[model samples]
Target: MPFRKFLGWFKGFFGKKKIIRLGLYGPPNAGKTTLANKISMDWTGEPVGKVSEVPHETREVQKKEKVTVKVGGKTIVMNLLDMPGISTKIDFEEFLQYGFSAEDAKQRAKEATKGVIEAIKWLENVDTALVIMDSTRDPYTQVNITIIGNLEARNIPIIIVANKIDLPESNTKWIEEAFPQHPVINVSGLTGSNVNDLYSAIAKYSK
Candidate 1:
């Protein structure tokens, strides 16, 4: 009994799992919040953030911590970060199309610009990043390249998620071709399609 107890203690000491800070980053309405919500709800039985059709809906850095996720029978503790939508330029006029008043639109734009800066600053804190991309759109955007380039410079682990794969317009091939350096997981955050694959990839790649 004593020997077994000592062995168990040794294993427990050596087998301590590290909590990975996983950031979900993408452009406007690309489903970063949705994916973060899915992951958080799947593991924690709760959501991390709200989803909206409006651009810059998530105008802040949202975090959900101590989420225990199971992937391929392996349990992982994760701190999920849902970052704001990043764009090369944010115009208040764009919000006018969404029926927002000029003042409200301008305020949202200001907050969104700040959110982008915060997301970039938080890159230093990310252990691994899941760069979410809209599968239906062109993948060769300055935002996507900038996000990937920054992650590359920091030597951070990246898992690109081609979100909205359930949409008929989605072409995962384009995203794959655009980012050949990292593994891409196709998922639909809205429909919860192929989310298991995402979990498996997270477990496999996120160190």
Candidate 2:
């Protein structure tokens, strides 16, 4: 293993009070950053990254360290990792709809591709993963399957987040049915609905 990866493993395995490396992972525009920002701002008084209508707006992993969350007299200190949105493919043409120039579109596609690789690599470093899914969209996608498979293969704890429950078309039940084995929390990161339930889940399940 690389020195950095080894160090991460060492700390997670042996450190006292082990600051859980909580990773936020999901498909593009699935509200990963929005939830991350909500968590960070609630605990650290800071936001993780910018929210955007554009896919891959968070083209890099954002970290907030030493965030202390307390629930029911129990406290969990963690390093929150806000990961880039994962996608099966990146097409430059997709950016054109957002009014991007040809050159910028291609550049964004390249960066998004790289971001996917980086997010996958960071999987090895995460202790717990929150798989955020857009409650308004179908949950049975290759991207979601791939992410869950990778995390499960590594024996990492998984919490399925049914985000955007505030939307009229949102069907959090569909997501719960899709991944019944994992714990699912319905939340609307944008409106902060049921977010307390998310925090309680994080406190309960994060390792």
Top-scoring candidate (lDDT): 2
Q: Which parts of model 1 have CA positions greater than 4 angstroms off?
A: 1-13
- Over 1-207, each residue of candidate 1 has an lDDT whose tens digit, in order, gives 679447646765899667789999889899999999988888889999889999999989999998988878899888999999888899999999999999999999999999999998998989899999999999999999999999999888999999999999999999999999999999999899999999999999986
Worst 10 residues of 1 by lDDT: 4-13
lDDT string, candidate 2, 121-165, tens digits: 999989899999999999999999999999999989999999998
lDDT over C-alpha atoms for residue 105 of model 2: 99
TM-score against truth, every candidate:
0.92, 0.92
lDDT of each: 0.92, 0.92
